[model samples]
Target chain A: MDKSTKCALCPQKAVVHLKYFNRKLCKQHFSELTQDRIRKNISKNELVDKNNRVAVAVSGGKDSTTLLYSLANFAEKFPIELVGITIDEGIEGYRSESLKVVEKNYKKLGIEYKILRYENEVGKPMDEIVKKDQRLPCSYCGVFRRDLLNKAALEVDADKIATGHNLDDEVQSILMNYIRGDFSRLARTGTKTAADTGFVQRIKPLSVVPEKEIALYAMLNNFEVYWGECPYSHEAFRSEIRDTLNRWEERSPGTKYQIYNGAENLKELLKGAIGGAILFECEICGTPSPSVICKSCEMKKEVR
Target chain B: MDKSTKCALCPQKAVVHLKYFNRKLCKQHFSELTQDRIRKNISKNELVDKNNRVAVAVSGGKDSTTLLYSLANFAEKFPIELVGITIDEGIEGYRSESLKVVEKNYKKLGIEYKILRYENEVGKPMDEIVKKDQRLPCSYCGVFRRDLLNKAALEVDADKIATGHNLDDEVQSILMNYIRGDFSRLARTGTKTAADTGFVQRIKPLSVVPEKEIALYAMLNNFEVYWGECPYSHEAFRSEIRDTLNRWEERSPGTKYQIYNGAENLKELLKGAIGGAILFECEICGTPSPSVICKSCEMKKEVR
Candidate 1:
């Protein structure tokens, strides 16, 4: 591999390139560019703080791996204390890959990893619950995932939890919410949320990164990923949103980028409209919410 | 054919049950259960009053035709005036059938009918404009249709513009709006609205009626209807919503109806969020809108 050639990771070649862990990447490293932008965005937007002991919501997916990797990189420079939190939903053939990648990355990066099992915590595997329940799979998974992530973050004594939600996902969600007119979800959605205040503040560092860039960065770094989709993803409405956004992106190449910028521009409008102060604690779990009981607690109680 | 048996047309056993008008309708009863239920819903909900002069927006489709037919029927019994308004979007190989149906229905029913040709009023047909502007045809068509409807409504001096939107359409739109997080649209959505100070209120008398019910009513009554779909509708994002909702509905009967009801429940919540307010006049067209310019004026500008 000729060093003079463009970095295999990112096509962009900047002059002040840095060699980290034998990877020849430009100063504008794909991961770094993404991570730095997200970090600065969150900080600038007043999302994260020095007092926060953040929980890394690791799923062992490429996005989560990149998040963990970048947070570790950021920690070397910043005084941020980070710990890994993984929730195993106990889906057959799915959780294993994510678990392996998450555990391996935590070990490799020397971060404390806490595995919260769904069956142990929620009293049943998501698959079993979904199979028996008449509710949509996504309805179950979303409620369970949120419940577990928040609970794990709280149990581990972390003030903030970081997840790897990307631009494509965010925009799709924005579009989906707009289409369905789901104002509550839209109002609640942001790069960071204090909704689960008693549990953990959730932040997305990769919120600005596009799907292509994340995939490229993951590939270049040879990050172990769970390539197959969740078997119970029949309820994933996001795929429709992804395709819709992708169509627009393809027709107008920079549309997705513009959407990210739009999100940034609309941040204040969204905050004002969505209102951050709507937070209250769930009566059942004492989790943060806009209502007396959080959605997850409501769902869990209903399911039971 | 079988008088004692259920009438294929009416699907109801009433004294007025007969295959009147050659459609094999069970009877020429003043109130078919669904139509009566719909009218009673409109009446009980106080959707319309004797003081109102309503413009029935017709597209020559089954739903709209059924709406107009029922509205005409209502006019006969109740002290109400009815006018039909059609906006011609100028799509090739389409609209002709619907236009014919509209004309035939109006002529037979002796109802006043007005046609707003897009070429004359909006200065361009949808297909031609879409080709030049690279915008989705339905996006442009929807705006034009709405603008024209309001324009024609105002032209006819009608208090309320009645649309043929049914349960499925409402559910799909609610879902789409929720998915897109557009609370504004969801806020103003329903069978009826207050004559919210600055705008002409729109009403959907067929609000409780399902699409199939409308189609059956149209077929049984021999109400002429355009069976073909809009040429540009394939590009619509709502189709995906429709598909998703359709599958959900099939999985659970009356699920779509419940979703519509859920949307109704959220109407107040949506209004308090963004996209609140009813139609205000378009500064350009002097038509009703919550936005500065009406959607039609916006689309016309976009195409021009």
Candidate 2:
């Protein structure tokens, strides 16, 4: 019953009995456990390359924190270099809190980190856009975040941008896009978005772990993750999809895993089978888009 | 604009148009529009019978009420009796409100009505069974509804039971069932379920009308409708499908219609080619089922 007792899965539990938090897992297994999930997802997806430089998009949530921690560990052993990047969405409280955690975690890991503040780059903050449009906060946040993340990765000369999106998030997105007949987004939703050109390869290392597991891991590891809901997330259709899937998970355990596996199995067929030609390069930004322009540009104009 | 003036296509536009809540349509056109949808759907589908003693399951919702009203009108001039059977699911507030509308409409139309209440008939009320069981509400509701509807048709000496299900509901059910890999339901879901020994055929007259249009028609026609949401529907996954389709509709107005039509066109292949024996007669109930015992009986025993 001792709070300081060795964690159950810790190899040290068998000998020295050193406990980290309340878990019986030794520091080694605890580290390996988190790393194993990250590595397995990457290997299974064929996402990482030995010669590729990876830029980890760290938002300091459980997902991004765990992702950065694991990628840093993976880079120490692999032939790849891991660099951390953060996009300051300029949300007064949430982004600032998240950035503090990201920087603290990166400094602890001694990883090369870059922070791209939206105010400095986008010339307009998300708060202003959200207040003005009132129709789409995500329209602005998603576009700016993605653009900044990719731009940061390219600036650092990374060949791939590694995101902390877990299995539940990825599968929910796949299901959402598929349900909406958004074949273009559906085609690009897997762990590795293969056909995307003029953009660095995007990979999700935690694409197999469930949301609860990541939260638990982050908690057990004493990660300084900001436990707060995104203000704009309530209106997000993605949140609705998440809640919908979460409700399903409550009824049938491991449904999220099944959905993840189903999405993975579908990647091969969906790549070429959804035969519409929306995969043209954006003439302005050179990102994959259905039209001559990217969604970001379209949204910016649409919002204006 | 004179408020008393009716829109050219709608008769009771002054009263019913309020419920339709959308400005683009008038009362008569609303009803005609709903009927046109059903007719077009029925025409495109290879399942409706011009001479068969087709039964319509009257639930008293706007969709079913409209379906019953239209079916009565269509059958009056055609060679069909259009037997109207209502299954009482025994849900409080729901069945009663709907019954009022149904009974009133049936009385005005002088259509023969069959009401099968669940508790005295199905051995137990669904509300009671649901309290004891952890299975989904729809699971019990669907099973009890289907069996009772079939039994009602047989008792009334009819060939097919027609339900008020519309395009949006059908597509949602299809996607939900398909996602769960329920091939049997997929194979069975069409405009008309085929004939098997001891089992009455089933058809959907409102199969093409959208739920919104059905609501509009019900309001325009002075059919009393239950406007309250099902207390248990919050937990059902169909709403997610509906929302998904709605989002898709926002993106592309005709996607649901196209998808249903695609499935509608596949009816022949589903019946003749796919050839699932799951619809074979159940010895106990003399209904079509894969086993000698039907799903309802199996569930009943399991619950007990």
Candidate 3:
């Protein structure tokens, strides 16, 4: 925002100052740096490969929009095909608003995309489920969305399912699992590219980038990013963690990265000790799960 | 405070409501339950055995006061001799006020105890160090206090050193390490009975109980605990974490205990992977340390 401040790499006046990196950048270099990091995040983890078909879960949020755009840009020179998988959770105002942005962006990119609805795929619309279930909407929404995403990615034959989980989401889940004393959950919190039987490997190319950076990246590139809060809202504990982490990120700019990097290392160490994830096919739906029945089937049973 | 509410075990009116246990207890039953948990924590961990001389690090704060009193009370039936090890950081009014409570409680219990002054043992009073050094007093104070506790415990021929680290403190340290990505420190944060070479084993019997419970126990038993905050304060990140955790604790009553329990389990898992504590004697002073020289010596040298 400081026009007088020049870019750290170039003479162009800085458009955004990144506190975590302690650097200022112009529009040109900022995009270069962000995209470069995203590319590194993908290649380092081998989330995508030559001739591999990758399905990205794009919600039209700033994070997903940025990820889709970045991947699409990279795909121009690369041999990989990018498919956008957007889930219409049917949250009334929530899904309808973001759906427009998803369609528009996918159209501009001209990438093959699929739109999956909750009613068609998961047995119930989220709005109806909200009315019937006494539980918070997030608990059900997460299970359903993840279930739908995985299944849809498999249908399109995605070698890996790349998600738009930014660094904030990564750290928040890590801390939440820690708070819950669930080591197994904590171990699986990492953005692993490994796949088990009947499950598609999920990858996060934007896991290293901060949420703010994603917004800025979206803005500078003029991507159609939908900024909307869900009517049903977030998990309460998560909101607390997100706000606390934000304040902490402000207090010390790169604290989240440190925690996340440490978590990744710790997760590897835990997986070694706990023997990684011991997933099995759900008895009801044949989905890979820790328990006899997958959460998707369990929730569907509850709703029915 | 609810006089009409009957104790879960007895006819006496319940004085305390413990949400973690979801139980109401009378004055007598509450004491019994807390002390029972403390005793189990000690015995289960093998922190103290028959004929062991245990030196308790009593800060005269509610937590330490509760720990010392609990040990002293247990010593009546057990053969273990309880020695009170109090540290005077010499922070003007900070040590002066607490020192009185430490002495009074020690005398009342008729336990032989030793007081180690920071000036005598660590080569600097905290006040002078605070004035001379640019760093926060806490950074220096914690190292000095820990060092003095270890040395003083050794001099008293104590087999183990016990401290009043409650659940809140335990969970906070676990999270702080996680936040900082210091897995080594994270592994060492758990209450372990095993001591490294040339160091007295340290234990925390109060690790199971919450801070609020300790305060209630102190007040209910009329323990004469000192209530004061030092002019030189906590680490900034810790304060932020503590406040955030307090709010989280309110949001979900048993959350802190869950986190602490999970941390304890996770620490064990990490210790196995990381090969436990790798300590060496300080080259200069021959104290047990992870590095070539112990932190106490490093800090002592810095002050000099």
- Candidate 3 per-residue lDDT, tens place, B14-74, comes to 9888866678999999989899999888888777889999999998899999998999888
Q: Is candidate 1 or candidate 2 better by TM-score?
A: 1
Which pairs clash in model 3? none
Candidate 1 regions with alpha-carbon error over 4 angstroms: A1-33, A87-103, A115-152, A165-190, A195-197, A208-213, A224-304, B1-33, B86-104, B112-148, B168-190, B197-199, B226-255, B272-304
Query: Model 2 over residues B1-304: C-alpha lDDT tens digits?
Result: 3355566444544434322233445555555666776766666664456687877788777877777778777776667777778888778887767788788878888888899987866677777777888877777777878888888888888877788888788888766754664434666766777565446877777777777767766776677777776666644466656776786666556767766654454343334434456456666666778787889877767655
**In model 1, what is the error at residue A213, expressed in angstroms?**
4.3
Q: Candidate 2 DockQ category? A: incorrect
lDDT of 3 at A91: 86
Listed per model, the TM-scores of chain A against the true chain A are 0.83, 0.83, 0.93
Per-model TM values vs. the true structure: 0.68, 0.65, 0.93
The sequence of per-residue lDDT tens digits that candidate 1 reaches over residues A1-304 is 3566566576767433323223456545655665667678667766667766889998888788888887888787777888999999888788876788788889998999788887887777777788778877787777778888878887789878899898888887765554454645655666876544455678888887777777777777787766667787874466655775676566445656665554444344445445445668778877767799888777766665
Q: Poorest 10 consecutive residues of model 3 chain B by lDDT? A: B189-198
> What level of docking quality does candidate 1 show?
incorrect
- Tens-digit lDDT string for candidate 2 (A171-245): 788666545545455556678776346578898888877777688778777888978767776455676667777
